[model samples]
Target: MWSNLPFDLLANIFSFLSPDSLACAKSSCRHWHQCARCLATPESPRRHPPWFVALPNRSRGLFCCAYNPIDDSSSSSWYMLPLDFLPIPTRPVSATAGLILLRSTSTTPFQLAICNPFTRQFRHLPTLNVTRINPAVGVIELDPGHQFGELNFRAYVAGGMSEAPGGGALDEPKVEMYDSRCDTWKVIGSMPVEFAVRLTVWTPSESVYSNGILYWMTSARAYSVMGFEIATNSWRELSVPVADRLEFAALVQRNGKLTLLGGKCGGDACIWELGEGDVWRMIEKVPFELGMRFLGGKGCWDGTKCVGNNGIVCLYKDLGSGMLVWREVADEGRWEWFWIDGCCSIRGQQPQNFQIKGLLLHPNLAHSSLLNA
Candidate 1:
């Protein structure tokens, strides 16, 4: 079989197959295994951008939907992924950067599973004992030198359980970082500020890493917002000028500036931008009628765009429906709406089914002009 087909051609065919298909192909025979393994190896030249978003489902558990911003016109392809192959918790938290990190259950010991869907390669991360009983997990890409071939990945687990039983209200947050290059974890230092004792199940208020800084909002038991810097390992109390009170706030980067978005404590949705000297300024108030809601709006900020769904309401409108609206602040800060359908939505009936666990964007299918040759 090896002599029959060109190895390069065979590798390209295997690259298009999902992880599950690759496994089956590997078992067919020795030749197939060699071909499959070569194609699945991390060093393979057929590596493609990880454009799939992992979503949780009640029936299928954790599944992934393919997303490609280049092919905005193509419908998204949803594929059910195998949870058994991965060491995922019952209530796992997932983050994507070529590889996906799945955090274990809250009650269980601290555990995580790092997976790369393209290569079907997975590594189970060891749990570290924490000072606090509950800790927050985050993933960030640091500047891995040119030797690693750009985008070296790492995971960080911050603010774990307090060591002392029945500790005071404020427990010092601890930080640990995992470097893929070294394939090990290290306790770096303690968080700059004290974290809330009660861990919120939702995503981190903000985990945007930019210019070597990871920014997130932490609330005390009193619900007061405190901002922290990961690079400098410092903490500070940030005053949100637009709202005296907020139910939840997320720190986002827009057009290269740090921004914040949240609903007022009284329930008015709003967006805020960080101005010079770290001053907070209100940019726009999202109208409730726009049908926008946020469950964990932390990852909503995708550079120039943000998307989230708390229930049926979505922050970004569908391009085909003529209802999806966006305000351009860098240009003129004017509101504009466009209609596009087929945008992913929370699947469920009314009332109890309104909760949206995930949001997905379709990929574009345009062929590269240079590839025509």
Candidate 2:
């Protein structure tokens, strides 16, 4: 019956399916698989489940873990990703779709690589000319209407200090962007000294890219969320809510909007969204139940962190409190919490004993073989 349908009709049918359901449909038949690809447009608004990249306690490799709060607790949902996919001690600096931007090590003169954990396809990126003091990587989909696994993407490396004679605070910071089309990197623009100084002093966590802008928070800048526009190569900074004594904060893309999750030690936290003209609008309050629970019976809240994607957000305290996640329901006004215990436990573990890096990602079928095209 699927074979009889016109191509346009089949594309429309597959468009409404979730990412996992679409993957299942593609496996039904060759015709259905082709239809799935045709419908996987960049503009397609279909959402995928959020998966946490759990750092293993035993090995240097990472684990892709997902927990369904609605599912029975007895079943196992975490999958240990193969270590052979990338070099040892590879740090995933950024993630989009299924592709994660990795560096060989957390150290200087970073060797860049891109790999899709789902497909286990790995590809190396060009080496940077300068080692960033506290560098961050940002990725943008260049092809206006491309699909999930397509290689039409560009990577921008910004806010890193350079290695050169007379390297000082006055040294201007430049943006290096890699274009997949040319397969080369170029210096785009130099940011103002104030921004460069912050980058030098404080290395931000992995940045969140939405639309054409890359956003990250800086403690040195009073916890301001900095935005870098890829097209114009410009910078904009937005102040976060409750900046005083913010122990932890994260910027993530939810429902295609740039969202901020800020948490304080005194049981204060809230999620905010970028409103018109770069305004930070509070969307949802971090429920007191979750905050109080994170406090772990203590009267005051400790440090906390926010990690998530695809409308699901996880909050975990620094002192080994279990993870509390909020998953948004479609067309529903309420949000509920999901308990993800394995990944959140690493907060209390020794840094060398357990490495915890997470990205809320949707599995993508795109492969490195497409890069040959």
Best by lDDT: 2
- Expressed as tens digits, the lDDT of each residue in 275-329 for candidate 1 is 7777877877765444233222342322122342111112432221212334332
Candidate 2 per-residue lDDT, tens place, 1-373, comes to: 2343455446756876889999999999898888888874557555334456553322245454433332224334444455565556676676654577677664556567777876777778777666555566777756534566666677777766666676553333887888776777888887877777665566554677787788877887468877798778889888877776666777877777888887666656778888788778987876777666666656454445567665678775432236777888767856776555543322243222243555655556455564333
Q: What's each prediction's TM-score?
A: 0.59, 0.75
Count the clashes in each prediction.
22, 2
What TM-score, to 2 decimals, does candidate 2 have?
0.75
lDDT of each: 0.46, 0.64
Model 2 lDDT vs. the true structure?
0.64
Best by TM-score: 2
Off by over 4 Å in 2: 1-47, 56-74, 129-133, 142-148, 166-172, 299-303, 317-321, 331-334, 343-353, 370-373
